[model samples]
Target chain A: MSWTRKHLLGLQDLSRDEIQLILDTAEPCKEIFTRPIKKLPTLRGRVMVNLFYEPSTRTRTSFELAGKWMSVDVINISTNLSSVAKGESLKDTAKTIEALGADFVVIRHYAAGSAKLLAETVQVSVINAGDGAHEHPTQALLDLFTIRDKKGSIEGLHVAIVGDILHSRVARSNIWGLTKMGAKVTVIGPPTLIPQEIEQMGAEVSYDLDEVIPHVDVINMLRIQKERQVAGLFPSLREYSVLYGLNRRRLDQARDDVLVIHPGPTNLGVEITSEVAEDPRASIDEQVTNGVAVRMAVLYLLSGGKDIP
Target chain B: MSLLIKGGRVIDPAGGIDAPADILIEGGQIIGVGTDLPAAKEELPAQGLVVVPGFIDLHVHLREPGYEYKETIASGTRAAARGGFTSVVCMPNTNPPVDNKAVVEFILAEGARNGAVRVYPIGAITKGRRGEELTEMADLAAAGVVAFSDDGNTIMNAVVMRRALEYGKMLDLPLSVHCEDVNLAGQGLMNEGRTSTLLGLPGQTRAAENVIIARDVELARLTGGRVHFAHVSTKEGVELVRRAKKLGLRVSAEATPHHLTLTDELVATYDPNTKVSPPLRTREDVEALRAGLLDGTIDCVATDHAPHSRDDKEVEYSHAAWGMVGLETAWPVIYTHLVLTGCLSLIQAIDLFTRKPAELFNLPGGRIAAGQPADLVLFDPKKNQRVTEELLVGKSKNSPFIGQELQGWPVYTIVGGQARWVDEIGR
Candidate 1:
C-alpha cells in the first residue's frame, strides 16, 4: 500500500494495485472533510509547490486546499506571476525550486512531456496536474473514485467519454485508468475531434453520443474549447450542441442510474445543457469535492505515509 | 607522398568489380590496382576490410554562412568523412539560398577551403527557395552546381515546377525535390496513423508526399527533365516514382536511413529527434521503402543530413525543428537494418550509397580504377559501433540513431588520396 514511485507523471505507467491503493487512501481522506474539524497533521513539515505554466483556477486551488488541510505549506508559481515570463526554462526554474528544499512539486504545463521532463530535472517528488494532451492523473483518479463510490465497484462498467477526445488529457488519463480497472471505455466524439487509432489505446470510438448513452454505466463529458471551434474542427457551437450535447431529452435514453461527469469548467450549453449538468444523477460537484481528497491522498502517500489503517 | 591500400575486397558497382585487390595512390589519384601493386610510403593493410568507391551523399545540409552554429563546411564534411562519405552534395537551402552564382561560388570556395570530403553545391531551384520566382538556372549550372533544389521547401505551384523542369532539362541538370505538399501536410508533426492518434499529436497523411511525387513525375514527363525526389518516405510516394520509372519518365528517388528503419511509433514517446519532414512512416512503409531499394524503385540512399542547434530540438514536439543529422549514422543504420537483415546485398547497398548517387549528379569517384580519384572507404562490416553523443563528430548530435548498436564501421576514409579519418583500432 506504500507509494514507491517518486513521480506520478501519467496514469498510463501506474499499476492496478497502485491505483486501487490511491483510491482506498482517498476514501479516508474524504471522510475527514465530513467532520467539523477537517485538518490533519499528516504532512505538517512538508513543502509543496504548484508550478503551473498554464492558467487554472480549480486544480490549483484544490491542490492548495488539500495541502493546507494536511498542514503542509503550499506555494503557487504561475507563469505570469513569476520569472518564467522572462523566458527561463522549466529546467532552470524547477532546479531553483528544488534547491529551495521543496518536498513535492505539482506541475501543469502546455507541453505533453513537461511533467516527465521536470521529474527528471528535480529530486523532489513530482506530480502531473496536467501536461498538454498527455495526462491528468489526479483528475482521472478522482473521477474513478467518484464512479466507484457511487456504483460500488469499478469492474464490469461501461464508460462513455464524449467530446474532444483528440485534445483531452483527461480522456487520455481516464482511458488508461478506467481500462486498467476493467471498465470498457467508449470515446464518443466527432471524427475530427477524436484522434486516429485511439482504439489502439484500448477504447472503442464512436461519433454518436445518443446511440451510446443507453448502454453505458457512466458518461464523462470533456470540455470543448472555443478555440477548437475557431480551429474549424466542427461546424459551429449550435450544431455541436444539437448533435452531441447531453440534455434532459437525451438523458431519458440512458439507464436511470447512469452517472454523468464533467471535468469542468464546462462549456455549459454546448457539450452539456444546464438541466442535465445540474441533475441529481450528475456527479460534477462530487468530482470537484473528491479532487481535493484524491490530491491529499497523493501528497500523503508521496510524502512517505505507510499503508496503515 | 603516396599510399597503398592492400588486400581488401574492393566493390566497384559502376566498374562491375567486387574482388580482393590492391590500390596504389599517388598525386591524389589511383595509379594502379590489382594484386602485387608497387609499394608506397604509407601502406594500409586491409586484410578483412571491404573497400568501396567513395560514398556520395546526394542530399546534405552543410549549414554554413547563416547557420554555422548548427554546422559548418569544416565540421559537416568531417562528420561525413567519419560516416565514410568521400563526397556530399550540399543542399541550397542556406540563409541566402544558393540561388545565384555568388552564393554558389562562395559555397564552392568554403568547401575547397575547409571540406574533408569533396563538396558539390546544389543551387536553389527558385530564388530564395520561395517557390514564386525562379533562380538564374543557366548561371547556377555554369557555376558548377551539381543539381538544383529547394530541398527544405517544395515548389507548390505546378506552373513554376513545370517551368523549372523545362529549364533544367535544357541545362541537363536534375531538379532534386523535397516532395511534401504544404497544404495537405499542414503543421503536422508526425505521420498520420495509430501512433499520432494515441499520442494526440497532429498527423501528416502519407498523401502529402504521394501527391507531390505524382505531380513532379508528370512534370518530369512533360519536360523530359531528370527529377530526383529527395527523402521519399511513403509507400504510395515510392509507388508513384516506381510507376513513373516503368512508364520511362526521367524520375529517380532517394530514401533516408530513418524512413527505411523507423516508424511513426517512435513519435509516441514525443522524442523530437524522431520528428522529421515527410515524417517517419509505419512499419509497412518501412518495408515498402526497403523493397523499393532492392527492386530498383529507390535509386539511392541520401542522408538528409540536417543539423540543428540544441535549442532547436529541445522543445515541444510541434515546435521542434524538422530534421536529424544522418551523415554520421547513415551507413551503420543502413548496414545493420538492411544489408545484414538480407533486405539488400552488400554490393546493392554500396551501389545505393555510391554509384547510383554519383550517376544522378554525374559526379566522379563511383569507380575504383587506375586514373580515377582515390576517393574510397575501408569498412569493417562486422565492427560494432554504439552511437553516443560524445562519439559524434558533427557539431550537432541530433541523430535518432543514438544508443543503437550497429554493425559496419568505417576504418579508413580516404578522400583525394589522403586519410581524412582512420580508425585507430584498425591500425
Candidate 2:
C-alpha cells in the first residue's frame, strides 16, 4: 500500500485504507529498537524541522528521536527563541524554514487550523503535532497502532474516551481515527468539558464513566488540566477525582481483557489512580513506543517512501 | 435641480404606494408621482426597474478620525451610495470614542466635507464606551447626534444601562446596544455548537448574547426607553425581542443581512472574515431571524458595515480581528435570500431597509412623494451580478460575499435629486 497525501493534518479526512496502510508500514519500524544498530538509512539525507509554538516535551522528543533513529536530520525551533518573538508572522517563519530546504515541517500552535494555514503557505510536507483543541494526527495514529497490536483487530471495538474532551485535541483525533476504523466511540466527561453538538461528530456522550465502563473494550483517559477545572466547570479537583477517577475498584468493574490507556503526563490521582496507571492491563508504555514507530512511518511515507510489504 | 424618473414601479411603504408611476423632483423634493408628468431638466427611462425609498443603514462603522486606514467618511459613505443607501447612522466606537459633544460635532463636520451620502453619528452611551459612567446625553443630542450607542462593547453594568435608558427617554432617542456578556463569551472565536467543536476553535454559546438581550428587554420595559437592539444574531434573542414587542414595550431589534442569510456553518473554513461578535449562529437561528423580520418582531435590517484592513484579517482565526465590510453586499443578499425567495414580499423587504430604520433613528428621507426628499434607488432584480473585490467601493475588501453571485443590482442611487452613483444598467 502507498501513502499519497502531501501532509498529515488530521485523521478526520483520511480514509480507512490510508489509515491501515500507515499502521501496516509502522509494523516493521517497531523491530528496529530491539537491534544494536537501531539506526536506518531510509531517510538519511532528509531534513525535518519541529516548529512548536506551544510548549510540549514528550511529543517533540518522540519526533526528534524518530527522525534520528531513521538517520534523518532534525532541527527544533521553539517560538520563544525564534523570530516569532520579534512579531514575525507564521507565513514568514514557514517561508524562512522552507527556503532553508527543510523537507518536512511539523507544527504545533495555539490556534486551531494553524497547521492547515502553514501547509498552504509552504511547499514542504507538513505534519500537525497538535493545533489547539483541533487534532493530533500522529498521536491518534500511535494510539490506533497500539490498540491494533494488542487486540489483533480494531473493527467493532467499543472505545470510551474519558476526561476533558472539549479542550483535548487528543480526544478529537482519536474520535475521528477510532470511529473511521469501525470502533464505536463514547466520549465520557463532565458536560462542561464536553462541547455541545459533539454527538453530531458521530460519538455518543456519557457523563457517568462508571455506567459506560462495562460496555467498552478500551478506555483512553485524557489528562485533565487544572486550569480547565478553574473555569468553574466543576467544584474542585478532589470532587473531580472522586467522580471520574479510575481507581482499582472501578477497574474491576470492566471486562478482564479490557485495556486502559492514557496520553501521558497523567495527573496521578486526578483523572486516574496510581494503581490503575501501572496496572498489568495498562498499555501506556506501549503507546509511547508505538508513537515513535508511527512517526517514523509518517516521515518515511511523506518523504516518498514508495511501498511496504 | 429638477429630475424625472419615468415608468418605474414605485414602492413607498410609508405612503403605502406600489405602482408604475413617474416621479417629478424639484429642488430635492418630489413634486409629482403620476403619469404624463411635466418634463424636467434630466429624465431617465426606468421601465424595468423598481423604485424604492433611499435605503438607510441603522448601523455602520465609518472608522474615521482614527482608523481611516480601514475606512473613512468618504469611502464608507461612497460604499453606502453604491449599495443604494442614502444615509447611514455611524457607530461611536472610534479610537478616542465618540462620548462628548466635540466628537459628535467633529463627525458631523467630516461627513459634510467628504460623505457621498448623509452620515449621522450615534454618540456613546457610556464615557469612552467604558461601560462605567454615562456620557453627556443631553449635550450630545443638542450637538445633532441621531442616537446613542456603545456599539462593539456592551454596557456590562446594568445600573449604568438602566440610568442611560431612563435618561434616554426624555431625549426621545433610540439607545442602540451591542448585546454580549464578555464573561460568558470568554475567548470564543466562533459560535458554540457542533461546528466549533469539529473545527476545534473556542465557541461562544448562544446564552452569551441571549442573556444580555433578555436583561435589556426588561430594562426597556422598566424605563420606557426606546431600545434598539443592534445585530441580534441568536434565536433566543429574537424570541425575547418578540415577546417584549408583544408586551407593548418600547423595544425594537435589527437583524443584519449577513445574519439573515448566513450561518455558523461558514465558520467551518476558519476564515477570519466570518469572525463576528455574537458569532454567526446555527441555521435554526438564521431561520428564526428571518421569521422575526417578516412578523414585525425585527423592525429593521442594518448593514453593521464594519471595516478591517487586510493585515488585520490575514492572520490566524483566533488572532484575526472581528467584523466584515458589509455595506456593498447588504442589498443584493437581502434581495436574493429574503425577497426573491418569497420569505418576505419585495415591499416588506424594502421597508426594513428604508422607512423602518429612518423612523427608528428619526432621520429624514423615508418617503418619495410630493414635498419629500428625492432620495430613491432604482433596482433591477433580474440582473445577474457577482461580488468581486474590485466591485467594492469601500476601503476594505473583507466581505464574506466576495465570491457569491446575487440577483438584484441597484441601477441608480439618487440623493437630493442628484444621481450620486449610477450603475451600468442605468446607461
Candidate 3:
C-alpha cells in the first residue's frame, strides 16, 4: 500500500489498487503533458542516471526528458560507449554510478533478471527502464496513460498489443498494466511469438493479427523481432510483412478513429507502414509526450521524491 | 563436548533393543546407550520422552546453485532438524545438476558452511541430468558422494540404465531412480483414475512408473547392481519392488509422507500443492504402502522436501509444480498417524526413522550407538504438537500440512555432539 522505496521492477508486483493509485497520480502528469510549456520542477537537484546495460534510444530519451523537465541532472551511460565496454561489470558500473550520487537509476538490460540483481547491489532507488526482455514498467505506465488520456477511462476498453509477445518486455509489462487497469487485453502475434501461457496472465491471445486489429479500440504494434529469424521463425521479413505487418490498407480496415500505437524507433514498414504512422489519428507524439510525465511519476514514486501532492 | 540424555525410552531397532535407557554422547557419537551407567558433566534430562537415533532421510530436494528461492541447504537442513533428522541425502536435480566434481563440492561446501545436519549429496548419474550421458562416478565418489540419482527426471533408456547399474556397482554407488516413463506420463497433471476422469484432468497411470521400475529391476539383476526406487507412490510399483526383493535381487524403495497418507482425491480441489509427479494415488495405494511398511516390505519413509514461492504455485494446477515442503511435518505425522493407529509399533516406527534409512543409504548414522556419529533426536513423545505454517524454520511456506494436529514432537536435535536445534530446551 505504501509506495515508498519499493522496486517498481514489474507491473506484476503492483496490485489492482496500487495500479489504480498510480494511474490517479499519473492523471495530473498526463494533464501537464498537453500544456504549451511541458515541464515540471517536481524532482529538482535529483540525479536520474540512465544505466541502460542494453542499447536503447526511445526509452532512454523518455527517461532523460522526464528527468531534465523535472530539473534533475540526467547521466546517459550506454553500455556500448561507457566503461562497461572496457571490461567493467554491470555491478561495478552501477556502484560507480551510484557513488557519483545517483538518487535513482532507470536500467535496461538484455537479460531477464538483470534489473532485479542491480537493485539488490545499489543503495539508490531503481526504476526498471527495461530488464532483460523481462519488463519495462514505465513503457507500460505511459501506454496506460496514453489510453486513458485518449479514451477517458482505462477500464472496459478492448486493447490489443500485437507483435513478438515472447521477446518484447513491453508486451509483458503492458499486459500486466492494462489487465490491472480492468481493460481486456488481447495479445496478437504469431503462434511462436505468443508466450506459452499468455492467457494465464488474464489476457486473451490470438495468432491472426488481421482478425484481432479490427475488433480492438487501441492497437499497440510492437517491434518486429529480428533475433529469432535465424532460428527459422519465418522465411524472410518480406513474407512476414505480407502476413502480420500493418500496411495502410490494414489501417483502413480498422474502426474510424482506432488509435494506431507503436513504442518507437518504429520498424517503419515492417509492423506499421509509414502512411499509417504519419496519420492524423496516430497520437504517436502524444504517447511520447505522455512518456515523460509517466516516467516522472515513476521516479517520484520510487525515490521517496513523491512530490508535494 | 558431552550430552547425557537421561530417562527416555530408547528404541534402537537394528540392535533389537527397546525400553527406557540413559545415553551418554561425546564428540558427536553415542558413547553409551543403556540404563544409568555413568554420571556425565552435562546432564540434560529427557524424562518421559522418546530417545532415538538421529533420523536420516535418503531423499530430499535442496534446490540451490540456480533456484535458491525454492530451498537452500541452510533452510532444508534446518527443516530436516525440525523433523528430527540428522542426515539427509540431497537430490542432484539442480539447474546445473551435481554431475561434475565442482558442483558436488559446492553442495558439500554449502552443507559444511551451514553445518546444521550432515548433508550427503547424491551426484547426478547423467551430465546436466539430461539422461543422455553418465558422470564420472569414480571422481564423484572420491569427492564424497554417497549415491546417484536424477530425482525430478528419469533415465528412460534401458541401455543407459543397464550400463549405469553395472558401472555403479563397480564403485558401490546406488542408482536411485525417479521411476516414471515420460512418454506414457506425457503432460498428465495427476494420477490416471476415476478421480482424474471425473475432473477432466490428464492423469498419469501407475503403469508409467511401474514399467520403469520393472525395467530397472531387470537391469539391476542383469548387472547384479543395487537400485533404490525413490518416493514409491503406486500400489503396483510397491508390489513390483516386493516381488523383486523376493527374487534375491538387490532392490529397495522409499515411501513419502504424502503417498502414505494422502490420495488422488485431493486433486478434485485443483490445488497445485497436492500436484506431485507420479501423482498422489488411490486410497488403495496408500493402504497397501502402509501395510508394506508394517510388514517390513517398504524399507523407510523419506521426505521429498520440495519448496517453491507463492507465485510459482499461484498459477493453474496443471501449470504449477509437483511437490510440497514436508520436513517440518514428517515425524509428527508419522508418529501420531502411524504409531497411534497400531499400524506400526513405536519401536518399528523409530527404526524406519533411524536405522532403516541409515542402513539403506550405507551411511554411518541413524543409531544411538557407541563409536557412532553423535546424531540423535531428543523428542518428547508425549508432546502433541499442532503444526502451524509459522512453525517452519525454512523460507518456503509451501506446506500442505498447515494446521495439522499431531502427537510426538522432537525437542532437541543434536548433530555432531552439539545441539544444532533445541525447541524450548533453555526455557
The TM-score obtained by model 2 is 0.97
Model 2, CA-based lDDT = 0.91
TM-scores for every candidate against the unseen true structure: 0.97, 0.97, 0.64
- Candidate 2's docking class is high
- Put down candidate 3 lDDT per residue, B1-427, tens digits, no spaces: 6778888888787778788899898776789888867887798888877778889989888888778887788988998888888999999988788999998899999999984899999998888888878889899999989999978779977888788888888788788899999988865677876565434355577889989988988887899999999988888888888888899899888898888888888875556678786689999999999988977778999988888877677544544677888887888888888888888898888888888898887898777678888888877778876777778877687776777788888888888888877888351
lDDT against the true structure, each candidate:
0.90, 0.91, 0.81
Show the lowest summed lDDT stretch of 10 residues, model 3 chain A: A300-309
Candidate scoring better on lDDT of 1 and 3: 1
In order of lDDT, best first, we have 2, 1, 3
In candidate 1, position B350 carries an lDDT of 93
Backbone clashes in model 3, listed as residue pairs:
A111-A132, B28-B374, B28-B417, B29-B374
Residues B299-329, model 1: lDDT tens digits = 9999999998888887666668989999888
Better candidate number, 2 or 3, judged by DockQ: 2
Model 2 Cα lDDT, one tens digit per residue, B13-84: 999999999999999888999888999998889988999999999999999879999999999999998999
Model 1, runs deviating above 4 Å: A307-309
Report lDDT (Cα) of residue B174, candidate 2: 90
Give the CA lDDT, 0 to 100, for residue A62 in model 2: 94
**Cα deviation of A243 in candidate 1 (Å)?**
0.9
